[model samples]
Target: MTSNSPKVLVFAGSAREGSLNKQLAQLAAKRIEALGGQATFIDLKDYPCPLFDQDIEAQGMPDNVLKLRAILAEHQAVFIASPEYNGFITPLLKNTLDWLSRPYEDTPGLGLFAGKWAALVAASPGGLGGIRAMPLAQQLLANLSLTVLPQPLSLPGAGSAFDEAGALKDDATGQKLDALCQRLVDSLAKTHG
Candidate 1:
């Protein structure tokens, strides 16, 4: 498509198959692509990092961590859908971000995240709709110097929210996600287009 669309990276905190967070992240990716933007959908499963350990880092960063960092740095915006675990971000997501926050050679500190735009979305089977996870994730991204979008998507009772085809069954909820995606794209263009 001959469109002025920014590159966006979309990912979920969970690595398990059939995770609601993954489904939501995919939906966000589609929305971005539908707007003529390039969306790179990444799975944390592909980039496994041991729990953050200073000793491990003192030796050297993992290949997967370096690969993930390079991939993230290519994008202008990020869309994240994190599953809530005991009212917090999943450990996998936290560790990945921790690695990304570290300095890399030839890049400024927080190179993967600095000046990037981010939007958060979450899906949970519980009543809170994964809203609780957004704050910590938002704070982390903000600390990395990303301009986080204030509005977020929290899909409660998400177990039954998607259809067999994986699209949100409720049109209204889907619309909210659409808006969030558009805002991310627009915000990125304003800053980095």
Candidate 2:
């Protein structure tokens, strides 16, 4: 069963003060809200989790990890803006997912991701638009049982893609971003109903 408004959580992988991925995430959240879904924007900087280490897990999950897990559980869908670091997802995003995927005493395995709906977007100053990272992110999420949208946004030359207001400057690119996000919003509404 679904509520009248499906809560969609949005977040970026980067913690940099002026990250391109953060801009993309904010734009996605606006699109989701415009489509009438409730959008919850989260900053990973505020919910830092330690690097996923087996020794650390044995010691017990950190408070921030637990907090992020609870926040994720509250959302019906998730939108991620990941940055590609050396042709891979940033350590920040990977670590957050790893910690969140761990099973709590009463939670089912893969509870954070299993059957979850996800949409992906990436931005980078480089010309490739962080496209190199999408497949890996998709694979990881798919492995965890997330039904990720097959097509993801890859904003090339992100350095100049946005205007002073943080919105995409290129009309074509902005439309593509909007369309991708709309697809996720519409799919989630359809699935929940």
Best-fitting candidate, scored by lDDT: 1
Please write out the lDDT profile of model 1 over residues 29-112, one tens digit for every residue.
988888767899999998889899889989998999999988997888888998989888899988998898887788766877
Worst 10 residues of 2 by lDDT: 1-10
Clashes of 2: 0
Q: What lDDT would candidate 1 get against the real structure?
A: 0.88
Candidate 1 Cα outliers beyond 4 Å, as residue runs: 1-4
Against the true structure, candidate 1 reaches a TM-score of 0.95
Shift in Å, residue 89, candidate 1:
1.0
Q: Could you tell me every candidate's TM-score relative to the true structure?
A: 0.95, 0.95
lDDT of 2: 0.87
C-alpha lDDT (0 to 100) for residue 169 of candidate 2? 87
RMSD in angstroms, all models? 1.3, 1.9
lDDT of 2 by residue, 1-193 (tens): 1357777889999989988899889988988888778788989999877788889889987999889989999887889999999999999998888888888878876888766799999998888999999999999888878899988999889988888888888998888888887888788788875
